[model samples]
Target chain A: MSSSSPEQLLAEIRHHCTQSWTLMEVCGGQTHALLRHGIDQLLPAEIHLIHGPGCPVCVTASERIDQALELAARPEVILCSFGDMLRVPGRQGRNLLAVRAEGGDVRVVYSPLDVLAVAQQHPDRLVVFLAVGFETTAPATALLARRALLAGVPNLTLLVCHVRVPPVLHAMLNAPQCQVQGLLAAGNVCAVMGQAEYNALAAEHRRPIVVTGFSAMELLQGILQAVDQLERGAHRVENGYRRAAAEQGNHAAQALIQQVFHPIDCQWRGLGWIPGGGLALREPFASLAVERRVAPPVSAPASPEQAQGCISGLVLQGLARPSACPHFRRPCTPEQPLGAPMVSSEGACAAYYRYQR
Target chain B: MCLAVPGELVSINEHHDPLWRTGDVSFGGVLRQVSLACVPEAQLGDQLLVHVGMALAVLEP
Candidate 1:
């Protein structure tokens, strides 16, 4: 299979390209891979790749960041989260790193369970872990919650913000402005939640959803499959990342997530509340939830003027590209990010800045 | 962060505490320690899709 190189795959894709096809890769990782390898440049002009709202950091609600910032300010609390999330600007331009600069005890953790060790060591203090991301990350946080329950760690609390892919895809497809003709599904997410959930969505929307991995060859192959499907007028769920993804996905991970988390209507930053879009701790693990312990200061929602010409909302919706934003390279570079898309490595703006721009 | 890379499990250490069971995962040539707490069923030489120092799923291939 390695002998049939990306060049060979590109030939196949070029042969199948007979019309204009606007496809959205649902994961930011794929977006980066495509740009890094120049796969997008190799594709036929008709095959337009639209970046989707797959970056967890880009889609995470600002209110949740405000809550994290509030928790980090407490003298008895130790806030832990992934590295990129620290720089994502919340409401009023404040972030966890900014709070840490002001003596807030916010630390970067490699894993959610690392906070469990922190909680064990500092029994007197509260260890609040920011649980974020899609299905790929949900299992890890859920496992941490179950372990916390089993270990009986009373000091650990989770600020949950897990999301699902299928629901958001459904919302995007149903939206009147959506121009996406096909999709490259997030492989890691499908590895946990399985591909069955996408079947109905594919049939209903009449758009092929191909589950793909991060490698350039995998993505090119996925795009090839999607384009072929579009050409044939066949809309179904295809597994291009068969080596890691399966039809049913990881059942053990799914079971663990189900035990620890329940679906809730959660708000996405650029996109508003999506029904059953996010996850919160289930009743059994409610005590470990951070929202119950700390009351976040509710600031007024961000105004259009406050967004400061950052069209991340349009970018996330695939209506506009990152470079299309007026402030994209001018004031919204990764070093001085005006939005989460610039701060997070997986964000579309960051990917475009590093590669295309 | 939803970004995860596929790594090959080199070995599994059963001597340590079971809850903290760990294995050495090699992504291409880079090696790192990953927790097997979530995937207790993971065996030696398994390809795991690792995220944030934890093996979230085992690749069938």
Candidate 2:
């Protein structure tokens, strides 16, 4: 790790930034940390930081949320998910909490393994874990799937909605309106999946990709590194959070994730579909998928945000600011969220609401 | 959500199968049981970056 302090890193960034440059931080956690610590404000006006669609809850397709609500409502099924997901609005403004309110056995779990315990306790009820996250959270869910399969926990099933970061970044950069000149990748995800994918992305897109952590110091260092690269007209992947991330990442976790899940084209709520963007259970583990047990509802082609008048799609793509939205603090407060971004703590909208507002 | 915390591994529950090994990790004063399946080489007192009850990586001291 660099010995430079946060102030030193900020100074370096300011000195390096001679021209206007737009950089997108591709993780909601980083976005939250940047705003929460006032790091964005501390940066030179030449360095523009745009938040990416890194919040899994914010990116999850409403069709999946509606399906989760459907599964939660089933009398014999107990649907469990992270608390961040419970408030995400689905079809007709319904959510998992609403299903729970109507006496559906929808439970909030801190960990995916907790769902295994819930399954063991209620042997008769089907426990479906709504697995949603990026590479960082995927390995844990993969471990859960492996453990369940090995221990013969037949009652538990996973509604896997885990996504990969690289493809989404590719989609974002490919967009005509994309203003991002460089990128700060999610460090925790890099800690698990490593920097190989990022190296490839950087070389292909010709943009600096810096793996960043969620601390003020780490975020500033990542910015400095990106700015330094941009100033030199050099594009490469740099590990700004070397303490947690590695070049190859955690091999054991990667092996387990590879053994259990395979890439599949999946939908992002507002971003639509991207090929190889999500993971699905493979072969023998496929039996543990919730879709095998319960039928999912046919969803409309339109994204939920369109119907709700939420411009989260544009916001997520870094084309619009959260505060610039007409519905930002009006009918779209956290108490009554019209979209998932407003509900998830890591979301840019929520960060803007809490800190920037 | 990819939120993880650095916690010190206070104790390990060794198992015949390495995949079943677990440990008690302390974050601040609170302690929770975390899976050590990924980091089978993890020893007691090692700081681990834990995410959703699983240790993804060991932080360098």
Worst 10 residues of 1 chain A by lDDT: A298-307
CA error at residue A165 for candidate 2, angstroms: 0.4
* lDDT value, candidate 1, whole model: 0.87
Comparing only chain B with the true structure, the TM-scores of all models are 0.89, 0.95
**List of clashing residue pairs for candidate 1:** none
For residue A108, give model 2's deviation from the true position in Å.
1.0
Model 1 Cα displacement at A164 (Å)?
Answer: 1.0
Tens digits of lDDT, candidate 2, A145-180: 988999999999999999999999998888788889
- Cα lDDT tens digits, model 1, A160-260, are 98898788889999999999999999999998888888999999999999998889889988998999999999999999988888789888788878988
Off by over 4 Å in 1: A1-3, A301-306, B15-21, B27-31
Lowest summed lDDT across 10 adjacent residues in model 2 chain B is found at B14-23
Identify the candidate with maximal TM-score.
2
Measured against the native two-chain assembly using Cα atoms, what DockQ does each of the candidate structures obtain, in the order listed?
0.64, 0.87
